[model samples]
Target: MNIVFVMIPIAILFVIIAGVVFFWAIRSEQFEDLDRQGSNILFDEDLPAHQPNKHTDHDPQP
Candidate 1:
């Protein structure tokens, strides 16, 4: 009962802060390249054969 009184105000404050941050990101062009990023992930070209297997970051196991 008493806890709800404390929690309600905190939750409202958090919602206001999150809304402000989202608006700031939109104004700063943070979402401008969303389409480019998705397309880039699907369209990466194959690397050269001589380029020592840069695909996996781990060492090759025997």
Candidate 2:
């Protein structure tokens, strides 16, 4: 029917636009290092633990 004629071109246009955006992302390196960002929060830097001050160190026995 008349609706089919309108719908077909709209669908084709949508596909073309999606393809262009996908290619643009690839060329721009948008997908590079995807895992690094996702896992960055999971692990922390291997910093040395803070030690207690000698003056504040206390041993108590009653």
Whose lDDT is greatest here?
2
**Model 2 ranges off by over 4 Å:** 43-62
Cα lDDT tens digits for candidate 1, 11-52: 999999999999999999999888898888787787545555
Pairs that clash in candidate 2? none
Give the candidate number with the greatest TM-score. Answer: 2
Model 2, span 1-62: residue lDDT tens:
99999999999999999999999999999999899988987886776688777678656657
Model 1 segments beyond 4 Å from truth? 45-62
Q: Tell me the whole-model lDDT of each prediction, alpha carbons only.
A: 0.88, 0.90
TM-score of each: 0.62, 0.63
Which 10 successive residues of model 1 have the least lDDT summed? 47-56
